[model samples]
Target chain A: MILVADSGSSKCDWVLINNHGEWVDKIKTEGLNPLLLSKKNISNTIDKVQHLLNKKHDSTIDKIYFYGAGCGSSGSGNLIKDLLYTTFNQAKYIRVEEDIIAAVHATTQEPGVICILGTGANCCYFDGRRVIQKTPALGYLLADEGSGNYFGREVIKSYYLKKLPLDLEESFEKEFGADLNLLLQKLHNVDSPNKYLASFATFIFKHRQHPFIENMLHQGIAKFIDSYLLNYKEELLDSPIHFVGSIAYYAQDVIKKSLDERGFIVKSFIKKPVGHLVNNIINKNIL
Target chain B: MILVADSGSSKCDWVLINNHGEWVDKIKTEGLNPLLLSKKNISNTIDKVQHLLNKKHDSTIDKIYFYGAGCGSSGSGNLIKDLLYTTFNQAKYIRVEEDIIAAVHATTQEPGVICILGTGANCCYFDGRRVIQKTPALGYLLADEGSGNYFGREVIKSYYLKKLPLDLEESFEKEFGADLNLLLQKLHNVDSPNKYLASFATFIFKHRQHPFIENMLHQGIAKFIDSYLLNYKEELLDSPIHFVGSIAYYAQDVIKKSLDERGFIVKSFIKKPVGHLVNNIINKNIL
Candidate 1:
C-alpha cells in the first residue's frame, strides 16, 4: 500500500491507495506546513489521523508520498521526514515534494501549464515528466494573485472601504463580524494571517450572485492571468491549462470565462488533486 | 519645546521645534511599528535617538507628537506613548497618531485628498480639520497597490521569470545576490519580510531609467490610483491630490503623468513629509 497526500497552507488531504490503484481509505487534517508547524505539532497531527489507517494494513504500507507547501526547502522537508519516520517506521520508502509539483502531476500527464489557486497561488510549466519552467510565486504576502486568500483579502478591503453595496456589506458584517479594529487585530497580532484572511472566502462564495462579488472574482481571475499565467503565454495559450485548488474549482465558471476571453483552453479544474495523484501513482507503478 | 515625528514601517523622521516656530534639531531612526517590535526593541530605539535631545533641553521639552504606521489602534499607540514616557520622563504631554493623519496634515491644510506612497500605500480625504472620508489601506500584504514594496515585488517576479532585459537582470542579481533559493529563505524564514522586500526598492530606484523599470513604476502608480484614488472619484477629482513618501518623491514624473491623464491636479510631492508636518504643527499649534 502507498500513502498519498496533498497539503496546502490551509488544509491537507490524504489517501491510502492499494497496489490495484484503488483508494482504500481517505482522511483530512489541518494544514501541515513544515515552516509553520513544529515537529511535535506535526507528530500530534499524524497521531490524530492514524486511527483512519487500518491496523492490519499499517505494516504493509511500504511507501509514503508526501507533497505539501513549505516542504520545498531541505530543512523543512527533513524535519517532516524525521517526524514521519518516528511515527511510521514501517514505511521504509518516503518521498517528499513541493505542492506545486504534486499539483502538476495530479492535473496533467501531458506537457502544459499547471496553476494552483488555493490559499496561495503558484504556477509552473510542466512537461509530461517534470516541471520545465516556473514563475516565482512570492507567496501570500507579495503575490497570491487569484486565490481564496486573494479573494478574502479583497473582501476585507471592500468591506472596510464601503465598496460593496449596502446590503452586501450588512451581510458581510453579519458573517465575519469584522470591523477595522478587529480586522487589524487578526491581521497584525495573529500567526496565521493567510488563513485568517482566506476564511472570508466563504462569505464571498456564499454571495457569488452579488454584483460586487462577481466583479471582484473577475478582477482576481484577471490578475491571476496577468501575473502568473501570462508569463507562460506561448505554451499556456496552445496547450491545455490545468487548475487545481478550491478557488479554481469553486470559481470554475468565472475562471473559464476569463480564460476563454484570453484565448486559452482550461482542460481541467480539480477541487482536490490527491485522488488524481493516487491514480497516477497506480497507473505508472513507479513506486 | 515640541518634537514632531512621522514614521512608517521603514524609518521615522523626527524634528524638534521651539516656541518661536523655528526648527531646532532633526534626527532619523529605524522604523518602529508597535505591531512588529517588542517593548525592548522600541525602548532600545528610543535610547538610540535620545541623545539628539540635549540634556539641557530635556526638562524644557514639554511635548512630543508622534504619528506613525501601526499606531492606528489605541493599544499600539499607548504602547509607544508608554515607551516614550519612560524615556522622556520630563515630557508632560505625549501624543501618538496614525501616519495617514500625519500625511494629511503635512500635505494639506484645506479640504483635499492625501496619499502616502511609501513602503506601503494609503490615502484619505481631509476636511481641513479632520479626515472625513477615506479608503482603507490593507497594508503591504493584500493591498498596497502602489508602494515601494509593491514595486519591489514586481522586480523580484520579473527577475525570476527572466522577463527583465538582460542588462537589468544582471544588475538586479548583482545588487540583491538573490536566486530563487535565497529569495525563498529570506521570505519564509526571516522576520520582517516587509523590510526585506522593501530593501530591494533601491534597485528599482537606481535603475528607474530602464524602460522595464519605468513601465513597472507606471503600472504600480496606475494600479494605486485605480484601486485607491478612483474610489473617492467625486471628491478627489475637484480636490488637489497631494502625495508623500519615497516612492511618490522619486517617481514624481511617473506619478504626475498617471495623475494628469486621470484628470487630477497635483498639489505637491514631498519626499519627507516631516518638514511640512513641522510647519503644520507650528501654524496650527494644536499641541
Candidate 2:
C-alpha cells in the first residue's frame, strides 16, 4: 500500500493506493504545516483521522509521499517526514516535498510558471526538467501576495481600520461576529492562523462583486504579478502560467485581467491538485 | 514654561519654551512609542534624556505637549502621558497626541492631506481644526505602506528571497551582515522591531538609484496612495498632499510622480516636523 498526502495550512487530503495501483482509501484531516503546528498538535490532528486510516494495512504501507506548505522553508520538511513515519509505522521509504511539487506535477510538465494561491501563495518556474524560483518562499508572514491568507488579513484588517464601506462593515460583523478582541485572540491562540485567516474567503466570495472587493482583487493580483510573475520575463509570454488553488479558481476573472494586461497566458487553474497528482505519481511509477 | 515634543518610532525631539515663548532647551531621545514600550522601557528612555532636562525649570514647566508614533490607536496616549508626568513632575497639564498632528501643523494648517513616512507610515486629512483619517493606524505589521518600516521590510525580504540583483545582494550581505537566522532573531527578540526594521532605510537610500530600488519605491508609494490617499476622493487634487519624514524627503521624486499621475499636488516634504511644529505651537500659544 502507498499513501500520498497534500497539505496546506488549512487542511490535508490523503489517498491510499493498493498493490495494483488502484485507489483504495481516502481521508481528510486538519492542516499539518509543520512550521505552524507543534508536535502534539500534529499528532492530535492525525489521531482524529486515524480511525479512517486502513489500520490493517498501516504496517504494510511501503512508501508514503507527503507534499505540504511550510515544508520547503523549514530545512527540508523533516518534521512532517518524522511525524508521518510515526503515523504509518512501516513506511520503509517516505519522501516529503514542498506542496509546489504536487501542484506542478498535477498541472503540467511543460516549461511555464506554476503558482499556488490557496491558504498560502507560492510560485516557481518549471524548465521542463526541474524547478527554478526567482525568489525564496518566505511563508505567510512576509509573503503570500494573492492568497487566501492575504485576502483574509486584508479584509479583517480593513474592517478594523474602518477602511471598509459602511455596508460591507456591517455585513462582515454580521457574517463573522468578528471584533478586534476576537480577531486578536484567534490570531494569538489558534494553532493555524493561516487557516483561520483563509476562512474569510467565504465572506469575500459572498461580496465578491462589491466595488471594494473588486478593487482589492485588482491590487492583490497586481502584487502577485509583480512578485511572482514578472521575474520570469523570458517565459512570461512564451510559456503559459498555471495556477492551482481555491483562491486562483474563484478569482480567475481578476487574475485573467491582470495577466492579460501584461500579455501572460494562463494555461490551467486546478482547485485541488491531489487527484491529478496521484495520477501523475502512478504514471511516473515512483512507488 | 512649555515642552513640545515630536516623536517617531525611532526617535523623539523635545523643545522647551520659556514663559516668554523662547526656545530655552532642546533634547533628543530614543522613541517613546507607548504601544511598543513597557513602562520601564519608557522610563529608561526618559532617564537617559532626563539629564539634558533643565532641572531648575522642570518643576516650573506648566505644560507638556508630546506628539509621537504608536500613540494614536492605543486609547488616548495615556501611557506616555503618565510617564512624562512622572519624569517632569510638571506643575500642571500634559497633552499627548499622535505624531501626525505635528506633521499636520508643521507642513500645513490648510485642507491638505498629511502623511508621515518615517519609521512607520500614517495618513490623514487635515480640515484645519482636527485630523481626519480614512483608516485607523494599524502599526507596522498590518500597515505602514511607504514608510521606513515598509521599505526596510521589502528590501530585507527581497534580499532573503534572492529577488534582489546580484550586485545589490552582495552589497546587502556586506553592509548588514544579515542572514536568515539573524533576521529572524532580530524580528523575534527585539524590543522595537519597527525601529530595527526601519534601520535598513540607510541601505535603501544609498542604493536609491538602482532600478530595483526605484521599482520598489513606486510600488510602496502606490500602496500608500491606495490605502491612505485614495479614500479622500473628493480631496484628491483639490487640496495638496504634504509629507514628512526622511523617507518621504529622500523619495520625493518617486512620491511626486505617483501622486502626480493620480492628479494629486505635492505641497511640501518636511524631513523632521519637530522644528516647524515647535514654531506652530509657540505661534498658536498652545500652552
**Which model scores highest in TM-score?**
1
lDDT scores for all predictions?
0.81, 0.81
**lDDT tens digits, residues A1-287, model 2?**
88898998888998888878889888888878776677798878765555567554453778888898868755538877877778767678999888988888888878989999999888999988798877666666567888898888888778866688999999999988854544554554477767787887677888988999888888988988887777788877678999999999999988988888888898899999999899887887643
Q: What is the lDDT of candidate 1?
A: 0.81
Cα displacement (angstroms), candidate 2, residue B18, comes to: 8.9
Model 1 chain B: lowest-lDDT 10 consecutive positions: B51-60
Compared with the true structure, what per-residue lDDT tens digits does model 1 show for residues A1-287?
77888889889898888767788888899888876555677888876656558554544777788898878767777877787777777788888888888888787778889989988888888867768655665667666878888888888878876678999988987887866766776676555677788888878789989887899899999988888888888887568899999999999999899988888999999898888877777887644
Which candidate ranks first by lDDT, i.e. highest? Answer: 1
lDDT of 1 by residue, B1-287 (tens): 88888889889998888879899888898888886666788889887767667743543767899998878778889999998988887888999998998998888788888899998888888877778545666677667877888888788877876678999978987888756666776775554666777877878789877888888888889988887888778887578989999989998998899888877888889888888888877888655
TM-score of chain B of each: 0.92, 0.95
| CAPRI grade, predicted model 2 | incorrect
What is the TM-score of each predicted model, taking all chains together? 0.89, 0.74
